[model samples]
Target chain A: MKGKLYGIGVGPGDPGLMTIRAKELLDGAQVIAYPVKKPGEDGTALEIIKQKVDISGKEVVELLFSMNPDDEVRKRCRAENIDRICGMLDQGKDIAMITLGDVAVYSTYMYLDREVRDRGYETEVVPGIPSFCHGAAKAGLPLMIGEESLAVLSMAKHDIGKVEKAVDCIDNIVIMKAFASIREIADMMGRKGIPLSNATVMSNIGMEDEYVGPLETDRKYGYFTTVLIKKKVN
Target chain B: MKGKLYGIGVGPGDPGLMTIRAKELLDGAQVIAYPVKKPGEDGTALEIIKQKVDISGKEVVELLFSMNPDDEVRKRCRAENIDRICGMLDQGKDIAMITLGDVAVYSTYMYLDREVRDRGYETEVVPGIPSFCHGAAKAGLPLMIGEESLAVLSMAKHDIGKVEKAVDCIDNIVIMKAFASIREIADMMGRKGIPLSNATVMSNIGMEDEYVGPLETDRKYGYFTTVLIKKKVN
Candidate 1:
């Protein structure tokens, strides 16, 4: 019998936030896969599941991933990784690839899911709590309430123009991975007269360096940072 | 110490999709509250928890919530419910209010959370797997990937105009509670010359009569319908 590939979301760095299905699948899986910037580097997805399930005896597969802007490099690396993962599946090993948030949302596993499925392997995507929900919950803010509209955008450097247009129409906005462009976002909010008080900046949520507060344009923030902006003007 | 309030999300109808934190809190809570349209009505939130945790001997608080369009009625009913909840807290009885999906997104708990805090009560919101995530996972589609922007709008009757503007700017969009405006949305999609192939319509996800398919304008969807539209035009 062929093994099925599973993409599980561990949720925003909290083992408690992980769905029961995710933990259960990870416990039973023969091979565990997660992305890392380089070989030997620990990933957050692993740390999260480690807190709840004792995976000391399980086989760990560290898939090298790149956040580099070059399309060629990313495609080549992803292709190589999928080939390696497919080899394990060929051996009838149930491989479970874990991600930070919902695998359907901005996850590297999302790209690999289609590729693995095309190779004639069964695939399942297990949904998890997205980081933005944790940011909203920690900030005690409603992501949206009573017909309010929400726009979630990945903020790149100089991506202020798209944000401006979204701000014009969307009632509330959550900008994920704001580490690279947090200063630019703060500047745009300043120029547009959007209050910093309206923003909830979360960095490394549920981690040791976790910070949930107003935007600090002058200071640098760790990855896993998200800035949630609520339009109080309206 | 005053009794604390908890808002737990049971997740889009699948008991296994519920976060470990949500299930753990519910298991220990003495008073379990869930919203219903009328007294003695069975809510999906209660049904979801029943599959996982045994709450048969625990106290059940049925919060009467109306989907009425009238603002005055909603406000009056909400005020009464909050007052009753505050009284329970006054007696030092902990209340766990359960909601569908994340409590921070379009849940009645969002409104009550603020009121409960203002009355000197502690409130905790445990985020859950949103229905949209499950919809995307079920359809085998990414909600947003690689700098893509997502707009999540609650669609009301005659709300096609807002969606049109969002379609112009957002890369992908998820319209929650699309039952009332499904046909109008179908008409708008056709009028704008956008292909229906890019849309995934999910109705009553993970429940009996659950339907996931392309837009069928002729059929009437249930109240839990959500339409996920991808802007392939961009």
Candidate 2:
């Protein structure tokens, strides 16, 4: 029998935010698979799990995933990772793949999950709290309410336009990977007279050196950053 | 010396999906407050907490908030609830106001939190897994990836136009309170040549009689229903 795959979302960098199912799956997994940019260092997802469940005795495998700007390079890395994951499934190892935030969101586990399923291996995607939600909670603000609409987009040049379009329709907006386009977003919102207090930038949420404050373009922020824009607050 | 407010999210109706922090606050809460419609019945949020925590001897308060279409009635009811809550806090009773999902996202707790904060009481919001994320995970589908964007809107006649606007831009959309506008949204999606497979509706997520399936306009769904629309699928 081929082993099953559990794509568990460990929550947005918060160990305390991890679900009961996430902890149970990680604790009972025969093998642990986590994405790591650097070979020896644990990724954010693994770091979160470690804070709750011990993985010392488990077969922990660190897989490298490319975050290169080039599309081809990223695709190649993903294909190679899929191949490696399938090979493990054939060995009857119940592998648990951990990712930061919900796998249903932008987590790379979504792609891997489909790949594993296509190869006739069983897979389960366990949902967890996303960063934007946690960011809202931490910032003491509501994302949306009472007929309000929201748009959640990746921060890119194209998204700047989306923000403009979204502003006309959406009452709230959350931009992930916001560091690269932080300046433009802050300026655009500033131009619209949407006070800096209405827009919040949270970096490394629930992690060390976490930041939650008014939108600022002056300083550099970490990779895991999210910007939230609200039209109304009480 | 007023009581603090903890707006706890219990997670999309699933007991196992509740976060460690939600459990801790509830276990330590001096008074538990939950929204209820009928006088003698516990709402969905309270029922979920009952599954994990023993509220037998704890101080549990049931709040009534009008869901009537009349805006004035709803506002009147909210004012009353806030007044009642403030009275509790004045007594230095630490209240744990639990909601169905993340308090920051369309939960009634948002209004109460703001009101309580305005009255000078500290309120902490603990995020939880939302129904849409859990619905996507339950359906074995990804909400969005790469540069794909997502729009989350409440189902309404006005939102039908938002969907039309969103279809041209967003790669994914999630509609909450979908039961009311189910048919119209389905027909619109159908008219736009979006296959039913691209949209998945999950009702009573994580609760008993949970459902996950293609968008069906002819059927009736519960209050907790969420509809997820994906532009593409693998």
Candidate 3:
């Protein structure tokens, strides 16, 4: 019998935030795969679940997902990841591919899941708390209220003009990967009449060194940083 | 000693989708509160968690959240709910207020949480899977990938022109409460050159009677229905 593939979301950094279903799947998973920025380094998804689930005698695969901006390079990396995952499935080992947040939202596992299913492997995606949601909760802020809309975007890919338009049109906005563009985003929001107080920048959410407050133009941000901008309530 | 407030998200509709934190809170909760459309009706959030968490001995409070479109009426109702919740808190009873999706995203519990905190009561929010994320997973669709942006809005409150602008700018869109405006939105999408194939309407996600497919212009949808539209990859 061919082993099934489970695309599990480990949630934002907190193991306590992990869903019961994800925990149950992790407990039973024989083969676990998680994305790493580089070889020989542990990924955040794995680190979050390690304390809660025992992994003795289990096969763990480190899938390298580079931060290269080239489409060809990323495609090649995804193809190789699928091949390695399929190989484990051929050995009749059920593999649980862990992702940092929900697999459906800008997650590397989404690409892997599509390829795995296209190759005729039975794949299931288990949802987890997305990072932005956890960040909003930690900041004690609501992402969007009744009748309000929210726009979630990554500053790395979207044009500044597009981001500005989103800021004007949407009631609430969550900008991911705002490390490089925080200054620009803050400037745009200011130009759009959105006060700095309405924007909350959170990094390393649910972690010991988490920051939640107004975005500082001088502060450096890591990859896990997210900025939430809520339009002033009228 | 004053009692703390736990704003728990039951998650879409599936008990299995609930987080470990929510379940633990529910299991140990002294007072359980959930919003109902009417006094005698059981809240959807309560129904979703009832099977997994034992609530036989818990002091259950049914908070009426009317679906009135009038802003004043809704505000009055919310104020009444907060008063009642504070009453429980005054008795030194920790109250676990249950909501359908993540409390941070378009949840009534957000309002209550703000008011509870303003009243000097300690409030804690536990995250749960949002309906759009769960619906996307169930339909084997990615909410976003790479740098693609997503806009989540409710059709009921947004003007058609604003919705059109969002659909035009955002890479992916999730429209909640699309029941009444399904046909109009479909027409708008068609005019904007977004094919019906790119849009999927899912109702009652994680429930027994879930529907995931192209939006039918003729079929009537319930309040639980969510329409997900993805921009065609060029």
Candidate 4:
């Protein structure tokens, strides 16, 4: 029997947030794979699952998925990772590639899952709680209550105009990867008459060092940071 | 000691998709409350949990949360529901209010949760897998690739212009409540040069009768239907 590839979302920094199916897959899988920016770096997905499941007997593979912007570089990295994953599947080893959040939402596993499936391998994606949802819950913010629309944007590639439009129109906006352009986004929201109080910046949610507060444009934030903006009630 | 209110997200139709925390809370809670359009109606949240956890001895209360547009009627309904929940909490009965999909995103429980919290009761929100994430996974579609932005809109209350703008600009769009305006939204996407092939309509995901296919505007869909559109590659 051929082995299957499971893309399991570990959820945002919480072991309890992981679905029962994810935990079951993690405990039973012979080979566990998680993405890392570098070979020696610790992966968040691995860290989250480690808290709940024992990985002492499983073969843990760190798939290198760099944060490089160069397409050629990223393509090469994905190719190598896919090759390694396929090699394991060929050995009839069921591999579970754990991801930080939901696999379908801006996850590196999506690319790897697509490549594996295109090569005629069985693949399954188990949805986990997305980070934005966690951020909203932690911040005690209601994301789109009663007829409200929500726009989730990654600031890494979007232009300022798009960000402004989202803030102006959408009832709730979640800006991911807000590390670099958080100041700029805050300024834009200010220009658009969006109150600073309406925006909450949360970093490392569900972690010991989690930070949740009003958006501060001047402060530097880590990559795991997210800004949730709820339109002010008139 | 006053009992706490746990707002649990049951996820989309699948018993396996429920988080371990949600299941634990469901099993331990003295009272289980779920929203319904009317009393005696079986709610989707209740149905999903019924498949996994036994509710034989637990007090099951179906809170009426009608979809009526009249503000006065909705307000009164919410007030009554809050009163009942507070009464349970006052009696030191831990109440677990189950919602379909994530409670933090577009959930009726948000209002009830806020009301409970404001009335000096402890409330905790456990995130569950949102329906759109499940829909994307079931359809084998990536919601946001790389730095793509995602917009989640409810067509039940949004105007055509807002929907058109979202389709035109957002990299990924998930349209909920597309039952009434699925045809119009399809036409708008077509006019915006977005290929119909890029859109997938999924209904009752993870359920036995789940439907996944290319967006067919001609077909009538139940309210559980969702339209996921990934922007056409240039």
Candidate 5:
């Protein structure tokens, strides 16, 4: 018996943002898996789906994968954990690993996808609404016009210089995973004449905690933060 | 009673890609509006949702809009149609206009969003799955790494040179709406020493018609297309 793996993106924390495909996968899958930073911590992806759909029906699997930064530790844990996941698949369990935003962009699920592929298991990825798209939509701004260049950057390394170069080059820039480095981004945008007022910062988009407005200097950044800088179309 | 207009995105002809919020808007709104090139033509947005959702409970509104390059004709038609949509809102109809992909990414809904704002009618936008994200996911490629830049472009404009410049400078490029000038892009990408075999082109992502593979020169481009050129990671 062979089992299939699904990388399903549930979109940013708004349940309504879950694509019809994601919902179907959730309802039909034999096992619904989600990553948790530690036990009992709220999952950004699971929270998004739980809001609208009753996920209690599926055989839920919680994969405790800490986001701590030890490369070797993560690799080892992921390998061992994936082997366990594969063991269940060996029992003909159709599994789904739900994620936030699009699974291709900055998703940890890629590691598992690679594992499944290397093990000769079939896998498919279901796309979801990206947080940046939601931020741009809420801002009432055009992310790409006739020929505008768009870019998405992660500020995890906290490299202000590299981020500045990106902002300098792209016509429209979407910075994601940028909580720790929001101040540097804001300052660079201001100095580059990008106009802080023109930029929009959306935190927890599409959820009750959703906040969207002119870039605020005082707002503390979080892992879920996204900033979209587009030249104000006059 | 003045009703509000919602510009919602129905992602890339896949019912599963439609966000949970987008589904709610599509179902609960008094009118579900969508754009079409000609009267009675199958609307992309409506067709996506009609598969999984029974929208028979909602009144359908078709907004006939053309994307012809003729400036005067397009501008005039857009203004008139927007006026008509606004009138529906004024008549106490809560209308949800569905656009393919995210409403803010090179989407016609952005124009409507601006027009509605300019007219002082309160409007909100619900974002959907972006085709570029979907393309990357379907192709099994990561869009960007930490501090890495990703550029998205369209090939219709003569400004392909400018796009090339950005692509040259950026780490990854996702070109959308490139069905018409794929050869030119392929040529430029090849000149840049970016392996065409490594470059993934996805069309109709998330839909049954979705196709993803390495760039093949013999293949003809489709209307809904995305080309991703990713830097080889060490």
Candidate 6:
């Protein structure tokens, strides 16, 4: 029996937001695996998965994926993780690897996918509502329009210039994982004469404790998040 | 009594791909509205919504939105559609207006949104998976990875240089609705040596009789669609 692997995004946090396809895969999956921040902490993705269905019969695998992108450290971690996943697959085990957001958009599951494909294993991706989109939903803003394009960025400082470029080129922009870099982004948008009045920053979208408000805020949020800015006046 | 408007994306023909949030709004919405291509032709979004839920109790409003960008024509269509939607909302009606892909991503809902907002009404956007992301999922390709940016473009025929700029600036490029301009885009990517081998063209994703293959196919698909160009070899 040829084994198969699933890259399933559990969505940002709310289990209800999980795609029907993802929910089906999670409920029927024989093996469930996800990347965790450290060794002991339960993966947030697993928690999201549990909200959807019973994972009792599924074999849970913890794959360590360091957020830091140091070449040596990441390579070592990915190799070990891929080995564990590939081993399960080789045994005809159907594995569903849960991710936090959409698998194609800035997801770590891509690394595992590359490894699996390289080893001649079959792999498929189940799309999810990107947290950025969820944030836009929560914030009640349109990110793009006719002849308008949107860009999704991350927390890196270099992303600031890209945000500027997107704002200049596109109709709207969404910056993901921007909690650490919101201050700089907000400042840049302000300098660019982009009104902060309508700009929205949402953290932990779809979660019970979701925060949605004007981008310029005194309260600090540290979570998987998005900042949405629309150029057109609402 | 409060009037509410929901901008819901019905996804690309597959009812399963519709987000739970989109489904919730669709079910609870009192007024169902969508843009019609012509008087008698079936609205693409209407078909998707019909497959998922019973629209028996809801009022269906069809607004003609011809793709004429002429100033008078656009203003007149925009005004008429906006009036119809706002009229229902004014009567404390909960309205869910359907769009094909995500309402925030290259959607005509933005045009309606600006009109509604101009009429002094609050609108909430429920994000759905964009056509491009759905297309990528169907093709089993990742759009972006660590530190790499993604750009979505709808370029004019003479805008190949602009397309090149977008490709150069971003890691992964999704040229949406570029079926007419495919040869130009394909030629540009080839001239730049940007791995056309891995590029995939997906039209009508998640729909019945969808097409997913290399862009160099003899058959041509010119419709609501997207192209995924993977930036790096995995």
Q: Poorest 10 consecutive residues of model 5 chain A by lDDT?
A: A204-213
First chain of candidate 5, TM-score: 0.92
Error of 4 at B223 (Å): 3.1
TM-score of chain A of 3: 0.94
Which residue ranges in model 5 land beyond 4 Å of their true spot? A66-70, A206-209, A221-223, A232-234, B38-41, B53-59, B66-72, B145-147, B205-210
lDDT of 5 by residue, A68-101 (tens): 6888887787887799889988999999899888
Instruction: Rate residue A218 of model 6 by lDDT.
Output: 67
Interface RMSD of 6: 2.2
Ranking by lDDT: 1, 3, 4, 2, 5, 6
| Highest-scoring model, lDDT | 1
> Which stretches of model 4 miss by more than 4 angstroms?
A218-220
TM-score of chain A of each: 0.93, 0.91, 0.94, 0.94, 0.92, 0.93
- Candidate 5 lDDT, B85-200, residue by residue in tens: 88988899998888888887887777777888799888998888887877767766677643467777777674678667776567888777777767887788777887777678
DockQ of each: 0.81, 0.75, 0.78, 0.73, 0.68, 0.56
Error at B225, model 2, angstroms: 2.4
| C-alpha RMSD of candidate 6 | 2.9
- The segments of candidate 1 whose C-alpha lies over 4 angstroms from its true place after superposition are A216-220
TM-score per model over all chains: 0.95, 0.93, 0.96, 0.96, 0.91, 0.89
Per-residue accuracy of model 6 over A30-97 as CA lDDT, tens digit each: 99988886887778888887876898868998888876658898888888888888888889989999
The top-ranked prediction according to DockQ is 1
Give the Cα error of residue B89 in candidate 4, in Å.
Answer: 0.9
lDDT of 2 at B56: 79
lDDT (0 to 1) per candidate: 0.88, 0.85, 0.86, 0.85, 0.78, 0.77
- The CAPRI quality class of candidate 5 comes to medium
- What does DockQ come to for candidate 2? 0.75
Q: Where does candidate 2 stray beyond 4 Å?
A: A69-72, A156-158, A190-193, B69-72, B156-158
